[model samples]
Target: MTGIPKTYQRIVLAARPRGPVAPENFRLETLDVPELADGEVLIRNHYLSLDPYMRGRMSSAKSYASSQPLDQTMIGGTAGQVVASRNDYYRVGEFVGGMLGWADMGVSDGVLLRKLDTTRIPLSTYLGVVGMPGMAAWYGFNQILEAGAGDTVVVSAAAGAVGSVVGQLARLRGCRVVGIAGGPEKCEYVVKQLGFHACVDYKAGNLEADLAAATPDGVDAIFENVGGACLDASLARTNAFARVALCGLIAGFNGQEMPIKNSRLLLLNRVTLRGFIITEHMEFWQQGLQELAVLVANHQIKYRETVAEGLAAAPQAFMGLLQGHNFGKQLVKLI
Candidate 1:
């Protein structure tokens, strides 16, 4: 803590977006690092996670969670090292993960912080693969979908943090996995790199036909990330009693309407669709993180990230993510 800076830069939610998010929605502020009280810890964040779910947080519309208040630090997950501490449980230099918002430094009372062990996995991954995204994938796939051997599992936004893990886990369970992504490059990575049996490029303008071709046996389970046309196409090809883990609806994040044209299939096919918010299910996180950590450490799982440099870049990076420009988990390197 000897060379710690007296002040730090942080990005706050300057304004709420009306439609698609813009750079004007965020504002950077420089503030003095506060003096720690009896049981507080200071963290120097290394990475900031920019996720699709964050878009919902930026709106005033009613949802499962409260909207991010304006003129405050933009809400986000952070991975960092404890630079200073007056807390007995957390010592200086320990790696940690927390909801530290979009800032290079944050202070906590240790209640919301989780000490991390980077020995088996990288610290940055704690914000992606083995963190909230990984837990969401695990809970949704294992608990809801319950996909097993001989099943045909389809993952939309397969190149992203959550969907990527879902596809790989399904593959590990001896299921035939098909990925739906935005481009030929992402599709190739899903099959060639992530080991999915097939990948359908939704941007190819043949979503329905291509998805049908990919899942000739009919989709047994779907980890849906992008809703609209991708979900409609998959729903049209579902087998009877298929399960759908409705995750993010990123296609409609910008106020665009995303209606499922084949919604009638939900009744005809007797599909079981469940939408979940991972934060509501905290009890399963430890169990899920342990499994994900081992898989990541042993190279049994693969992940990719598109990182923007510094706090000021988070807004642009996040906007790009919503527009489907990012290839994988979008993040900001704060340090």
Candidate 2:
């Protein structure tokens, strides 16, 4: 970075969003890069991750995390290379991953950054299947859902990054896996590519009927990512002594309030529903990542990505992600 440009590009939250995020909610700007202090490193970001969880940060809601400040660089996961380093632990030119936000370059004190090995998998994958999303799936499905052989496991938003891994891992454990996705194309990918027993198209307008037809044995476990009608349908089809991983409520993230319509089923089915945030379960992450890395490296677990080119594309790409447009992991390429 001796002769590198002194400025960096970034996007910030222009205003707090009231409902569905519009392009107006974000602002793009450039600023001169600051000189690094001791124990700090300068990162030239190559990829920025777009996820449904970002929507929660835009609002001042009582969520698992605190609200992101307005008019600041929006919070997000990023993978990049260290262009300059004052930290002895990390060397320059080494790829790293951290929560560096939506920027072409960022500075860090090495507290949150992790060194990445691009020789094993694609560098961008650190933001997807081999990273946080994959850990979420592993912890949510194994520890929470607890589905085993002869059981039927159903996952909502099952074609996205986390859900894709959850269904595939359930299948590996010999469970009958069913996926709930938005469109016919995603449903096809969920069943054909991910090897789920069946996939129900929720956007097809017959969620209850489609789910019922897919899981005739009644859902023995659920790894729920989407809420609202998708959750309602799963609750209706759950079996006795079933377990559920209430991972995320993507359908209600944008201020849509959807009340559960079938509370009676919880009592009748003896279901166990637990909500979790992956960060809170850091104890399991190292083991989970090691296993997930092997699965990903050996192609035992498959994933897809819908990459949006450039940092400016992040805002629109994120809006599309909330609406279920991305195929697998939604990532913005900042190279």
Residues 1-335 of candidate 2: C-alpha lDDT, one tens digit per residue: 67777898999999989889999999999999998899999999999999888999999878779999988899999999999999999998999999999999999999999999888789988899989999999999889888889999999999999999999999999999999998899999999999999999988899999999999999999999998898899999999998889889998887889899987898999989999999999999889988988898999999999999999999999999998999999999998
State every prediction's TM-score relative to the real structure: 0.99, 0.99
Alpha carbon deviation, residue 120, candidate 2 (Å): 1.5
TM-score between model 1 and native:
0.99
Mark the 10 consecutive residues where model 1 has the least summed lDDT.
321-330
Model 1 misplacement above 4 A: none
How far residue 80's Cα lies from its native spot in candidate 2, in Å, is 0.6
Residue range 19-137, candidate 1, lDDT tens digits? 88988989999999999999999999999999998999999999999999999999999999999999999999999999999998999999999999988788889999999999999
